[model samples]
Target: MRIGYWWRLAATALLGLASMSQASETAEAGNLVYTSGSQGSALHLGTRLDINVQGLQAQVRVAQRFQNTSSEWVNAAYVYPLAEDSAVSGLKMLVGERVIVGEIKEKAEARKTFEAAKASGKKATLVEQQRPNLFRQEVANIAPGEIIEVHLVYSQQVIYDAGEFRLRLPTTLTPRYIPGVSRAELLGSASVHTGASGWSLPTDQVEDAHLITPAQHHNTPGRLLNPMSLNLALNAGMPLAKVNSATHKLAIEKPAGAAQGVRSIQFAAGEVSMDRDIELSWLPEPQAAPVAAQFVSQWQGERYAQLMLMPPRELAEHQVLPRELILIVDTSGSMAGNSIEQARASSLLALNQLTERDRFNVIFFSSSTHTVFEQAVAATPANLASARQAIERMRADGGTEMHSALSRAFDHDSSGEHLQQIVFVTDGSVGNESALLTLIHRCLGDARLFTVAIGSAPNRFFMRRAAEFGRGSFTEIATADQVQERMAGLLSKLQKPVVANVQIDWPQPVEAFPRTVPDLYWGEPILVTAKLPPWPSRSDARVVITGESAGKPWQRELVLSAGEAPLADVGVPVLAQRFGREKIAFLEDEAYRAGNSEQARDTVLPVALQYQLMSRFTSLVAVDKTPSRPAQVTAKDGAIANAMPAGSGMQAVGYPQTANGLLWHLLMGALALVGLLVLNSRGVVYVRTEFTAAAGRS
Candidate 1:
């Protein structure tokens, strides 16, 4: 199947621009007016832009105000507000005139085109996109003089190295519709201001710098300018700054030879707060280890599924141990931003971990693919250095082509003497998980695969699944700060093979078994638990397990005695299998959400309810709905003894209270309304409005 075609469809749906089978129109009630405003908290040095710092949360308030601008009575549904062109700058790195890095496009059309182009061996181009990490959308209705309020809370990662930060927020009010007037008028003069410290400059300074010029005196003028670049020579030590203009935000530049320090920049447009934070630290000296290995694993049951680590180890007996390694990195357009900085750091760390005994190669794919050291190379110092240099010089410029990368990684040629392994590191933003999974199933080999996830919200699903399919492990680096340590831990796992072709069996038919056994790595102990039939009631059950050690296969057996009971007992293995199944189902639900298929979304509900499960996008809340009834009347006393009679027990109803539910409801309503409008326009259904008054003496 062509993956690109599906990608485009998904992308367009996400952007709310796709011409689906549904149509919608704006409906207003009363003289309702909605207004929103945003504020920024911090600033960055290199660029005079607001950045969300690691430990700081930014606040944004969206308020809906209702006013009787018209002399009519009416009631209406809630008004949903969406922010247009809500773009944050300064935190992004620009190439030439374009914001080359750090822009996320939610446009379905552009995404479709991009995915299509990728499949056709062409570059996926982005027409327009927004910052995916920071933005807001809200909907609500109000009666005359009634106001509803909402707050958008979020945090941003500091991407630059600097000591100061700043933010400026400017707001405006617009009406959905006017009864008499063709257009809405400005409610009042709007102003910008700062709330607290950690920033310098007052509200007036920003207004003065951003106000309209007297020479061009134009009414209803909006003046927001995207500055080409900032000049950062003058401001050195200030840790915060802001520029609040309805038309333009502050432009900051980095000066040569500036001292390193933490900085934050903020921009506020009415009720929206956009920030960019910079964390500056002195670059540390390069360090290398002769050989090292590390392992990390969470407990599954009484035993463990080991994630093995070994820089180097001697082979035991006649075991056939072969080595394989694959390196996959994202060179997509988004990665063109500070992502390159982190990628280079991680690549270099991986190279340092290789030893002379191992064989490995590097694969860099974006719109295309490139390999270093020509095929797989020996882990000699000369080859390692060359590989390191090649990765450091790598640049980000292309759309993601994940399928091709995986296919090539699994097809790498390996000698039979060493164990095979693949290390995949990426931001994981592609929309073709199914296709990748199919390829993984086809390419299953003795080789294990490890995944290193990069970026703020990298695709955890892909990382975890890829590792599981390849029989390896997965790790993540949330920021550039954690790249080194995370990479080091992953590399250390390749030293030795812990267990090979391990299997377990019981003398009598076992009641329960683990769906799959965890692969044992070097330096890790083996632990397995199984359930036997009720003890004492049945003969002592014996269990047997076997696996290859060195060149010979080994076996072990155990007998358990238990008394038979009237009630069934839960075994460790049974519980482990149940947990594994639940986890797998959760991952599938996540994939469905990301795919955005109506069928998939619908299917998740039943499974979720069956599991009594709550995922990242779902929650189950219980509500009591007991009706209150009037007290019973006694004929003799003609007085009430009790206020109310006992009613049916409180009923519990399951209600979905997540963003997904809200989206589903909105989509359904829009579809129904579109259908009604179509019929009315076609003369199939007649629609009319009439006003009637009750008879009264005037």
Candidate 2:
């Protein structure tokens, strides 16, 4: 049976208040309705996903419908997931025939505007970013029995790896572990008792803990809580050897006698459950894989091009350098279920790959850190056995203190002849990404860091960015079955020499994003977007790329012509959007190292405003001019819960509880209990028995 959204929220809030005296105990025991079981709430959440893929890029539209099933005014809040690097360009609220468009404003200003409009009983929508991959949408004064739909559109460059092009749509997110001092010391600025769907308290580490920590519901067999539908159209431009989905079952259809190779794919089943990530992959035919592919368009008297350059295969080389591998694992409460199992298995596999020439150490961390050995040890039988036992004995509990573990891994001596490689194995469920990435950037020297993301809904944003900063690569293992296959490919890349010192030369002036090209891993291609000078002559323009593999230098060049070429595709805006995202990320990294400065704003805000993207300093908001709800009616806020990620346990309830959270609830409960006891002692409420009278009568 379906329940009303506001009614459920109201009930949760009342329960929350009543349990204030026993807050810590209730939290520890997982006694609340939202935290007690794995069953999903009766709240119906409907989602529709529309995707369009255009040669290495994807444009996506997601429409979420939230309906109020009860007879009370409710304020709805939903925290959802999107690709970390997505360039969000549009947000709209659908109300009957009115389409309210959202405008970009500074985050604080936008929040203030939305709050003011909401206080005036005007219908308003606010979209705020809690993490790069996580977002919260607020809809104020939703009337009883009202149905509201929010549409969000974003664009991103697709992932190309290991000869396959892949795209992933995260339907849900795993609960993240935020580590820091207790809530009493740092303290949160927001209310902790907001009727949010997830089991978590406001923490000192993550200020918006109430916003990000959502209630998670278990999925029962044959009963899916959140229903979602997806439709995808791929215009690969070249013949496809095969198209497949790694996560869900989908049907692929190719039109008969199609002019160009366009494949239409749809979910095989109807209304699939939003539990795991939806991953789709396709491979081009052996003959169709281009050595060099280029697309060009002209805008504002300047030329722009998106180019892909595939490096020639390397010949067998005899020399192989030894490595120093540091494997770091997370044993936080969030990793208590299938995630920990997968992490352990993946670590064991990684250990087996270490040869005698390599030396390694294992660091297991949760609230604390433990290293298998004080220093890196050679991969001998006894050391491997000890490492295996340590991994086997590890359990998930406590806080997610990642900084300590990371510091230990990166603080090693740098004068060793062995190549230092740190393999971080976790769900990437930490909230402090910017701080961690900054730490990596500062401490990383001659050491490469790779991220092995485990579990169903790991934070790919952190994993991907960490790898990018560490000059390594990132891979995800969503299910136990994929551990071997995915790990093998990753191991192979690690064994090979990476292509470094890449240089791209153009005949004329050109400005490119990254401004610096990253090292290319084995089986990967160099993809670059550049703003080029206008054609010098009617003749073709030459572009050359040079890189070093092992000790050998390799170069490739392509002559690009503006005229008389049928392959020219219009790619200005998408190219521009990609460039904008790259530049913003670079600025953010800089600001994280050195505090935010006017220089960053002068460089970033203009680009962000010009590109119409939401960032740390900016937000997207929409408001209705006419007041809908009456001023007499009080407004309340509630958070929508996300479904529990598959393979995870009931540990999602507000983990890493603080003394303040527990003692506050306890004090209230103790006072209430004392009042009840006094009333009983005074005979205010008494019970009488007729036992004496019955005995006398007998």
Candidate 3:
């Protein structure tokens, strides 16, 4: 081919490539995919959160309202996140005046039932757990202008540490990075993958990435955007000095007269955009701070109790251990904006916390891992300066290759003299969480792994479990401003001794979980749930918990008879459901460690069904027998995109777009132009003879 011909072809291809770049950039904000004829579906979205905090347990009711205003019959789906340890207990589907209660069944069975109901034109809703924190709710057979509301209720333990009790309410999730090879179809042109509900297909590492990785879209006129409100009624059972939220402004008021209690709390604004996780923390009066607590409930005439034991901060006070701290920060594409800034600030703050006796290193990971130093080094001023510079120079881009990053940190040939603690700072956006958790379970020897979750909405499930498996703590830094304060708290705990090798003794025969206890730090406590024999036969039940704090054995004994310290007596099934949830977590962890999730699915099924809770092995499904749609009309699927986490600068979820209209159309157009250019370069199409010049290529 003539040089001029090649030059002309090169220029055409470059223009096409630029257009593709812009389209792909738009995809980051989200590519909401709706079935044909449903693009104009008017979606009205709102979520109501009703939370009640009693003692150490919180029960949350989530009511998601999705109204379809389009002329066509439609089915809708929404993907969202919950607290990692939430014990989901109830699901109800409401339409107009009737209600259909959800029942827990094996995941496959639930799917079959939902499909059958959908095929028969009946109204149905299926809720399944995609991950510990991620969930998917699908509703079928909605008539035109019909309103559907799926209400979910779950129970989670309130975290108490260092004089504050904390609870997390997750509204959205960060766009996770799915690591591994994309399916051949996914790698094809955008046309081949268009209209898929999720941005990602099933990858080799994450077989169900599509389920968890929902697409995001802005609150455009034709798209569904979720905006939610949160209302909490807190009866702490005691006096609280203050109550506040780090993510949302609070509006607190005493419920009607008799007014001395901290009563009901709400958001200052009526409704806020659902983009970030809310961290609600409350400070109790010093004298009201609990040292031990126990809540009991009755289910099927059996007693279930939740236990909490704080092993005294004084023990961790006098003990300090020489350490080997390895800072692993993620510089992935999802962390490109405020997320990266927080990670950077956190890394620097941690470096400042190292003592003379501690040895430290820094590692950054995106598509690949980059170590600041080959191995752990003394925390001298010079070495610290070098680490800080490397961190400051880091930029966020590429995929989140977490597996390689973690493996590199826990290399077999690392130091064994000092106590090694791995501090992983990231947005926690990876999809292959079980694989990473399994790796940590096997590789984490004596070293502790502390995960600092960055960004507005991180993967709480992975962050919590990774820390649990590595015998450490999980800290969340949502913004750049939070980095200094949160990192300081985490680092201070890192320098102190953790209460390890914990064992609990119960007064009577009972079924309880977590089978094993992880370490406790600072004022952190030990929480356990148990199913006891029918009550009234035992002596005043005294629960004893023992552990080692600072190389010294420590013990705490609490009377479960219910006097002053811990509130007792309950009517709800939250504790019982929590026991089942914990049991399932234990079994799943064991299965993950053994590398056989499918083989162990059976072990978690019974627990899930028994407690009426949702799990990986089981799901909650509600079906209304009456058909809601006409037989002649087909139910078109509606695309309800997940809201991207706040501060994720990608322009789709509530941001202005540089590119507009159909993405696949633009892609195909660009591809066609490139094809024409290629044909012209080969002389298939007529081109001027003088157009080919070697100098033109340059």
Candidate 4:
């Protein structure tokens, strides 16, 4: 009698789960079908970015305005990308006159708060991080013709290397490939985030495959979407000699009486489609170039400091060594157009750079791995010709099997006399980043890995993190024109170690991020952050950095008393936030490197909560106390689309989605309950995951 009652109760509770397929929306041109009962006019979203740069750090405010054109009420969502190191610190929702400020909360609590507000017919917003570089923002209860704007503020450090300070802002993402069997395939019963559907399902390796592999659609030239407005203000703290953008034309503003060190820049075209990221770089005055600098801030009675030090340019004498060179190329579908061309050009350049003393091999991967030679062979004329012909004939197709390629490249004997180096060229478009990074950490074995990021909008997070793990450097080549200039420099650097055995000595006891220092490459800087325990507030402390450059001991020092010159941007809160972000990243990397993520959540929670940061375990949520929608009116949910990344998959036949995120899994717990009840309350219960969709981007 008890079993019968439980069975009947389960069927009644999860009836919606059995009928969810009927609610699926038909495939609209580029709009992803993510929700049940999704109807009415199309939803639209507008974006604007305001960037402020001070010295080596930048803070950006991104506003996403969701416009509901139809008469029916709707809930809107969007998926977007930011710099990999961006520390999301603020979120606010604007409803006409009232600005609802968001508060940091545990991920589950934030979701609950948003859902409660949504059910109460109140306007609210929620922002969550899926990956370090990718985020999903949702606004609830947007009325017809209403413009609800969500403002997000994040901070990041600018890249200062090779004689310039550079920054990239991501606008669109590349659809990443998810590898592993579906949970259903492994267990005969699957757990999927049915609230949102994409081109993929949940896999064993990546439980959130549906979130990262957002649906994409063909973005024809005429029907481009997600236009953006950009504004930038630069304060170099010192006079600048040159400023320019590699991705867009800028209109430099020279206001009367403005200091030469401060400048305002705007997009010459005003508003542009969000098809790719914009990259800007600047060079400081030759006389004002800095070799060492430091920024410090305080939080909760403790002090935080970030330091940058560069070794002498002439510290290393270039010495060529016999090397075992391996060139691994990506022929994935994402590299179908200009991306493939640039990668091919880079491969050929690397092939020609190999000397007769080098033992070389070639690898190409897409869906599976392939090798030109089973083992490294002397770079003789015959081998060189064979490699050149194979590279030239490579075509882009299938999924990006990056792990297989790396395994094949690094699985050989490293005990040889030659210096072992692997040059991996790809768009870095795979979603299984932790798996690959962990693989490198385990099997690296005296082998150095260098990544050549090839694409107009490559995954910067993967490129930067992989190189850091491999104890190597990364170079980004955005176009065919940059192949020669960029590849030549990278190939040149691979010939010898720029700086190794890097170590830092602080004047006092401190806890630093990156617990371990990494090897520095040509034109690279040693950047670090730390927390200074309670101590005398003295200004005489010094930080000494030491590294081995060309078999010589190299040292540089920065006086902590000397803040940035001109006395501006010394104690900004963003510096502390940057430290918090780094610390959280360190915890994550350490946990990942250890091959276990179970403790990562608990380890990073304290830092994220104490610093009010948005992290993997924490989120930002805003709620309005007053109810704005009538109880009689029902609100439909829709996803606002993003522009397809420029020059990506130009020849691909089909595209699935182009936008942010809004999916409803009404069967959140009902299906799990049913599964348990049906199996005499002993079967595994799979709770539905959350909603999100976006490529792993810059």
Measured against the true structure, the TM-scores of the candidates, in listed sequence, are 0.42, 0.85, 0.86, 0.87
lDDT of 4: 0.74
Among these predicted structures, which one has the highest TM-score? 4
* Model 3 residue 448 CA deviation in Å: 0.8
In model 3, what lDDT does residue 416 have?
59
Total backbone collisions for each predicted model: 76, 10, 2, 11
Better of 2 and 4 by TM-score: 4
Q: Count steric clashes of candidate 2.
A: 10
Arrange candidates by lDDT, descending.
Answer: 4, 3, 2, 1
Query: What TM-score should be assigned to candidate 3?
Result: 0.86
Between 1 and 4, whose lDDT is larger? Answer: 4
Worst 10 residues of 1 by lDDT: 636-645
**Candidate 3 segments exceeding 4 Å error:** 1-33, 37-39, 184-196, 218-225, 257-261, 315-318, 534-540, 562-572, 651-698
Model 4 residue 310 CA deviation (Å) reads: 1.3
* Native-to-model Cα distance after best TM-score fit, residue 35 in candidate 4, in Å: 5.2
